[model samples]
Target: MQQTYQTLNALTNFYGAMTAAESARRGYIFLGSSQDLQRYYNAKADMRSQLQILQKQIHPDESQEKRLVSLNLLVNQRLSLLEQSIELYQKDKTALLIQNNITVSSVQIREKILKVIADIKAEEQTYLQDSLEQSKQSIYFRVFIEIFTTFLILIIILGLCMILENQWIKRERIRDLESSLAQEKKIGDLKIQLFSMISHEFRTPLSIILLSAQLLKESLENLVDRQQLKNIFRIQSSAKIMNHILTDILILTRAEAGQLDFKLQVINLENFCLNLVEDLQLFATTANMLRFQKIGSIFKANIDERLLYSILSNLLLNAIKYSNNETEIYLILKSEADMITFQVIDQGIGIPLAEQHKIYEPFYRCQNVENIAGTGLGLAVVKKCIELHQGEIIVESKVGTGTTFTIMIPQENT
Candidate 1:
């Protein structure tokens, strides 16, 4: 019976030693896994730092402080639980060592060790599950945050693109509107010019005709034969002026409508100019000089003779009308290396300095020459005819001194 009691005591001592060793093994496992906990804490700290950075990146308008407080509390609770488990295992190890003695078997000790190992593994699995759940939560939150940030950025980019597109469309519409307005203004200006031309140009010629007819019937009929004949001739001359002015108007209208057909032919330029000078002599009775200086060479080129005649006639008429009585007008013809230049020089009430630039504009007559008999379309027609021939015309004038109109015409090679 003593032997039997000794065996039972030995069995008890072996079980106690096994329990203490198992407790020590569990303590070592807890200590070993403490590094894992520390690592988890470091990961959480890194996550918190990243979360803080992400929060900073977010606009202050969105909610932020609540999420930060909740995450800090959860991490603190996990650390508290880990420290408590470590303390419980340490106390159990001290209790097991204090309770045993005297001849224990290795097999019994191993059985107790196996039971502790199974319990430790169970605790480890629980800890792993909790960590996995936390990781999944962290990952899901991170993914959600990234997607939200990307969506906001895309929306901002789209807004800017839309704004830029709207600005571009607005500018294009403004440009189109401005273009339309400019076209309407040009049409309105043309209509005004036409009205002025009809009133002034048409009225002057009609007045002359009516006045002459009335004078012949009422005042000149009682005169003697020679006086009566002179009066008739005066009436005829007035009619002729009216007819000439009408003809110029018709020609210019046809040209503007693209209905004027030119009969292009080569002509003797010098002879043509001479004949024009002789024809203009009759109208130069108002102390206007029409002098044609001869060019040294009899140079000729292909041109529409009728068009050239009109150009020269209009230029000389303008000179005569603008010049003061008895002012000597000059007609100069110069031949350069590649061009022929005709110049009309007059010492009249010259164009004003400010208006010289605008003189070429259609229907815009010089303010100084308003008293003169003009339709204001003469220079415009001259310019158009010259442009048709692919030539250039320039005018230089000084107020109260003189004016010079130079026509530079291109010569086609034969």
Candidate 2:
């Protein structure tokens, strides 16, 4: 029994030490602070000491000891990569960080270490369970032999044993739930990291494409030919679309990871809505016009400007994309005493009645709109932003006529 507890304690401590080392390494890489580096070194030493204790505790189980050895090897490999990452960052070689294998290998090694640790813990749990069963059987058999005649006492002891068994089962269920939650958290972190890496990789090329397209547009302004200008515009538009998709994915991942933040401030909603419409009008055509309307005299409200911008901009852009160029779009801002409402009305190819509920799901597009070029992320992003603001949106639409989106958010965030 003592051995089982010692092994379980060692496994828990080893995992904690591994987490500390990882946190410290990433912290040092991000901040380049001496204190962070010192923490990493301290964690590294503690990890080694913990491993020694873990090896000693699990020595009776060959399988667990072997798992520990494998874990140690992976930890060492990750530690080396972590050190290399710090060295490269300090030398102004961050550009090489993505091209090299260090980042990928480090993540793989860490995951492998975690797997080994989980396996060891599982084995330890089994050992403890087996020990408990043996102890239970021995005590029960002896007690029953001594009190075989005392039927009431036997019945009472049996009831107590059943209660203890149920409690143990409940404890095991809780532990399993905790383990599942931990796995989910790990998956969420990986998603954020993977999306972040993808965004970083695409951002530079997209920026260059936009810049080049802009330069070409400017340099060809005097040319008689409109074909080259159109091509340049196409390039710019495509790059912008790609950038928006990347941004949406990053936002969704952050929101899923519970990292999205809301910052509320007092602002004039009327002015904000007007400015947003004006900015969006730059993308409008002579055939398409944007009209803005404001209701209520006092327009000041507390809200997160960025989240509101995302929600409104996404709706407006979606309106523009799905509508005829000659159609008019209306953006209405209605500020009340305790609530503010935004209505974006567009004469566009409206959403299907059957699939309207799925529009807010990530990567879900209406079957009718498959011909249209979209990643199907805009509405999802808008929905996420609205949810962050603790608001609600109503969509009123017809298949071929038009769509109206109304969003209402409380003036004071609760």
Candidate 3:
């Protein structure tokens, strides 16, 4: 009973020390900013006036912050030292109680006190990490505000310049200014829409992957069955989907900004398409949904192998995703006079007439098919990739009929 009482007292002291340390650290952080320091002093004086009332519930020990002000140790060491001091104080208090015949000596009390100190350090480390994360969030918020403010300022300057020019010049300038502003607004809206779509689409699937992996890791004993392997395959499929979305965003941004770099080489188009089809077959829900409609003859193309692969892969993946569960997705390659045309035809819910024009706009989902899953940037990336290769994409679709995307690229130079 005596030993238990000592342990309780030690725990109480430890908590009190931690609370005091936290209060002091907050006080110091407050001092770092003039506005916060002013508030702190006002609050401190009010507390000082109510000390008698506060003392009823608070400890009489001096604040840990004040005691460690002169120490030169790192933050972790300071916290550990404070905990050690509290442990010593608890031991002395316990010893005094024993001397007065109020309690008895406890075995291994020192070891227990040290263990408590270690636990306190662990908790403090956790607190420190949380604080760092909060600081980072604050910094990011400030940067976003600053960037938006700069954009507004530029828009205002452009408006003023348009108002002050000569009559004829003013008309032309205003037209250009309005056009630029409209373009900027479109870009901003698309970015916001894209970010929102990405956040929602990626979070659920990524979380599933993580949760499934964690479960398998924790209990492999009874989970070594066909079901477990199927679960693992599910995670792999989700990861591939995420990778495709990320690749689309990257290639789209690079192409839009005219920064896309390519290494041209001769690649066997037939073998390339075959390999791609094989790799993507695993991602298909059924074998029939994914197929390669072979070209009339083996054809070769001189192009960036990586870019071409990404373009075809993105197109094929989207066909599989947007098509009906059992519908066929065809990958047809045909060589004409001086170009090769690749067609991805899907017999799924067709694009609406109203949204057909906006299909290639970044993050612009068709109104009729918003229920389907997509980042809405897939087709935009496909268009950019085709344009970069001096190619063109033609879309033919009818509502409730189906859609076919035809991409034509110039044949490789001999």
State the lDDT of candidate 3 residue by residue for 350-374, as single tens digits: 8887778888899988876757677
Q: Report the lDDT tens digits of candidate 2 across residue range 238-333.
A: 676667777888888888789887898887687688778876764565424888888887687888988888888889878888887788999998
Record all residue pairs in model 3 with backbone atoms less than 3 Å apart, i.e. clashing. Answer: none
Full-model lDDT, candidate 1: 0.58
Q: Pairing residues by index, what is the TM-score of model 1? A: 0.44
The model with the greatest TM-score is 2
Candidate ranking under TM-score, highest first, comes to 2, 3, 1
Number of backbone-clashing residue pairs for each candidate, in the order shown: 0, 0, 0
Clashes of 1: 0
Poorest lDDT segment (10 consecutive residues) of candidate 1: 97-106
Question: Model 2 scores what on Cα lDDT?
Answer: 0.76
Query: Per-residue lDDT of 1-414 in model 1, one digit per residue for the tens?
Result: 222223223333434443343344343534545544445445444544543443343222222334334434543443344344445455673443322321123334344444533443333334334444445455445534543554465467458657755765565565677776665455445434553454465555455554434433333243346545554555554554544555565556656655566776767678678778887775574533788885657446677787777777778877777777878777887765467788888887788888877865667798888667777777777876787778898888887788898898887666
TM-score of each model, in listed order: 0.44, 0.54, 0.48
Distance from true location, Cα of 43 in model 1, Å = 99
Candidate 2: 10-residue stretch with minimal lDDT: 142-151
